[model samples]
Target: MSHAHDLVPFFEFHLYGKEQIPDLSNLPEPRLFSTHFLFHSLPDSIAKSKCKIIYICRNPFDSCVSVVFHQCNCTIIITQIILEEALERYSEGINEFGPFWTNILGYWRESIETPNKVLFLKYGDLTGDVTFYLKRVAEFLNCPFNSEEEGNGVIENIIELCSFKKMKELDVNKTGKMVGKYENKVFFRKGVAGDWVNHFNPWMVEKLSSVIEERWVWSIFLISLSNTYISIMA
Candidate 1:
């Protein structure tokens, strides 16, 4: 997902819809891009190549709440719609690409089974140690992260650039438009981890847990493997 203002200095091919993937023959071999497109729908090249895939996910309950705020604040169609209606629209996958669960599960499975290509990340982990994970991402993508600069300011730069507060404050993000027409959207909503604790009740949490158990077991494993890899690499 673009995650509102998350699209800044990092992007290339943006294929989120089912329409078409324009002529990429002119594009460079190793291209970078973001998409709400699920793994099942990704281009065949993605799976076969050595390209790195960073699949970031949050707890469904928290994701759902954040998504609610995102829809209301960013989307033109849902801006005037009631929260319930907006949620219904969300469940129906009326947004940028399609249904959230299907997309989430698709990547979850692919990332777990194919670790060399996909690196599944958690929003909570990134929030905890933004710099560390950013470095990990660099390593995963085979991008240069000079060992000589470990104590230097590189980490700080990335953290500051990618910080929720900073990204949200960007004039372009705060006012720029995307899939929807509303410009009031902010990429960084309360980027706190476990914010779901404040909103989810027993029933709701149980429901979300059941869904995760049924469809996201592989994703959970991928997260575990990712954590291990990060620790070892670090």
Candidate 2:
């Protein structure tokens, strides 16, 4: 499921302020859910439970670009603004589920403090070394592949099935509608890192870099990652 709302209807209801909380007693254990909600805003049950969270954060530049295209394709009333305006709003943390730094840092700190509960993954790192990270994820979920499974090419098959190209070609993804409105294909854009350079000019780069430098200074790891992205894409 793409979101928690698919299985737990009340998550959507709660998000929009509907009072009804659906009974989840019928759902089986080990239920997987995904959300864009901030760390602090998550339900108390989740905070207190022994559930694991895997947060995959993309470089802000690419994230902003992707959000722009996604909103424009999925929403009506033309939420798509010019890149310049989008960059301004993004830098100011005005977009959906933003301010980006706050959202990232909240999870970043939590992952540090409670490593077993939160596994923080960087999108760039995952794409760069899928095998290593995929194994990491499997291990994190307590289902690491045995040597027999590895020899049988299970990992390779899983990677190929989940690859962006393969997923984009799937009939369900190509023609499906999500949330009864969004075309599932909208989520399958370029699916590559560093595509932000095509959309960002020199000024935009400087502006976003300044924002990251200022806001992310507290986290050396994030700042280093941001700097590496800037350098590679420069």
Candidate with best lDDT: 2
The alpha-carbon deviation from the true structure for residue 125 of candidate 2, after best TM-score superposition, in angstroms, is 0.6
Q: What lDDT would candidate 2 get against the real structure?
A: 0.80
Candidate 1 lDDT by residue in tens digits, 56-117: 98766677777777756644443323544554555555666566777776676677678768
Going through the candidates in order, what is the number of backbone clashes in each? 0, 0
Error of 2 at 202 (Å): 0.4
Those runs of model 1 whose alpha carbons end farther than 4 Å from true positions after fitting are 1-21, 25-30, 74-101, 179-184, 217-234
Regions of candidate 2 where Cα sits further than 4 Å from its true position? 1-19, 74-81, 218-234
CA displacement after TM-score superposition, residue 118 of candidate 2 (Å):
0.3
TM-score of each: 0.71, 0.83
- Every candidate's lDDT: 0.66, 0.80
By summed lDDT, the worst window of 10 consecutive residues in model 2 runs over 1-10
